[model samples]
Target: MKILVADDSRVMRQIVIRTLRQAGFDDHEIVEAPDGAAAKDSVASENPDLVLSDWNMPNMSGIELLHALRASGNTVPFAFVTSECSDEMIAKAEAGGALFLISKPFTAETFRDRLSDILG
Candidate 1:
């Protein structure tokens, strides 16, 4: 499976990739995006199986990217890997068709627990 991970911080993206590997997702292809706008473009160009994006990003926010994908009728599984996990954000993510939200400082177990069924 191809997973696109979008985050403004390069370090965070690397950390996420490492954690994904630790979660036993080492076989999958990982595509990285520096911000949501690039992520949106990558969705169209790369056609990833899933998107794991940071909430707050430059150019476009993760939620906006989600909305844009849905508006374009692209139903590729989308989720968030962000630091902000307020009630409002969760509600908005769900309403916008996100599969799940994985907050930052996450563990390998969290990725496994949240992504087993989806990845399978």
Candidate 2:
């Protein structure tokens, strides 16, 4: 499986990648993007199996990326690994067709658990 880890912070991006490997995704292909716009380009070019993005970004927001993908007819699985995990935010993401979301301050166990439900 291919995973796209998109976040503005280099540290956070590394954390997500590390957590994914620690969570048993070692065989999976991993890609990284600094912002939503780069992620969009990646979707078209990289053809990633999944996308994990941050909520807040410079070029475009994660939600905006989701909406753009939906509008452009891309049905690839996408999730947000965001710091701002609110009911309202989740509702909006769900309404926009997100696969799942994991809140920030998460653990490798959390990544494993949430990812199992999605990848299993």
Candidate 3:
């Protein structure tokens, strides 16, 4: 599986990738995107199996990326691994066809649990 990890912070992206490996998902191919706009381009060009993106980003937001993908008829699995997790954001994510929204400070176990439901 090819997974795209999108975040403005390089450190956070590394953390997410490390967590994924620690969660026992180390065998899959991983890709990185600095922002949502790059993520959108990667989705089209790379055709990743799944996308894990931060909510707040420069150029384009995660929500915007999801909306754009859906609007353009791209059904690639998308999830948010962001710090912002308001009820409103959650509602919007769900309504926009996101598979899941994982808040920050999450553990490897959390990644495994949430990812199992989607990637399995």
Candidate 4:
């Protein structure tokens, strides 16, 4: 599996990939994007299996990124990892084709479960 992680913070990107690795996703090919525009470009070139993105970012927001993906007719799974996990946000994301909305401070167990539930 390949996962494209889009976040403005390099630390957050590292943490997410590290947790994924610790949770037994070492086989995945991980790609990093510092913002939504970069993420979109990465998606165009990387063709990753899934996307894990931050809600807030420079250049473009995660929601905007999702819209762009859909606008391009891409059905690759997307999930948000952010401090904002309000019902409204989740609903909006779901309506826009996000596979899941995961809250911040997640664990390896949460990653394992979320990945299993969404990708299974």
Candidate 4 per-residue lDDT over residues 16-104, each given as its tens digit: 99999888888878999999999999999999999999999999999999999999999999999998999999999999999888899
The prediction achieving the highest lDDT against the true structure is 1
The C-alpha RMSD in Å for every predicted model, in order, reads: 0.6, 0.9, 0.8, 1.1
Off by over 4 Å in 3: none
Model 4 whole-model lDDT (C-alpha atoms): 0.93
Which 10-residue span in candidate 1 carries the lowest summed lDDT? 111-120
User: Across residues 1-120, which tens digit of lDDT does each residue of candidate 1 receive?
Assistant: 999999999999999999999999899999999999999999999999999999999999999999999999999999999999999999999999998799988999999999989776
CA error at residue 106 for candidate 3, angstroms: 0.6
Question: lDDT ranking from best to worst?
Answer: 1, 3, 4, 2
What's the ranking of the predictions by TM-score, best on top?
A: 1, 3, 2, 4
Model 1, which residues run further than 4 Å from truth? none
TM-score of each: 0.98, 0.96, 0.97, 0.96
**Which has the better lDDT: candidate 2, or candidate 3?**
3
List, in order, the clash count of every candidate structure. Answer: 0, 0, 0, 0
Name the best candidate (by TM-score).
Answer: 1
Which residue pairs in model 2 clash with each other? Answer: none
Error of 1 at 90 (Å): 0.4
Q: How do the residues 1-120 of candidate 2 rate in per-residue lDDT, one tens digit apiece?
A: 888999999999999999988888788888999999999999999999899999999989999999999999999999999999999999999999997789989998998888887665
Q: Please, what are the lDDT tens digits per residue for candidate 3 over residues 1-120?
A: 999999999999999999999998989899999999999999989999999999999999999999999999999999999998999999999999998899999999999999987666
- Name the TM-score of candidate 4: 0.96
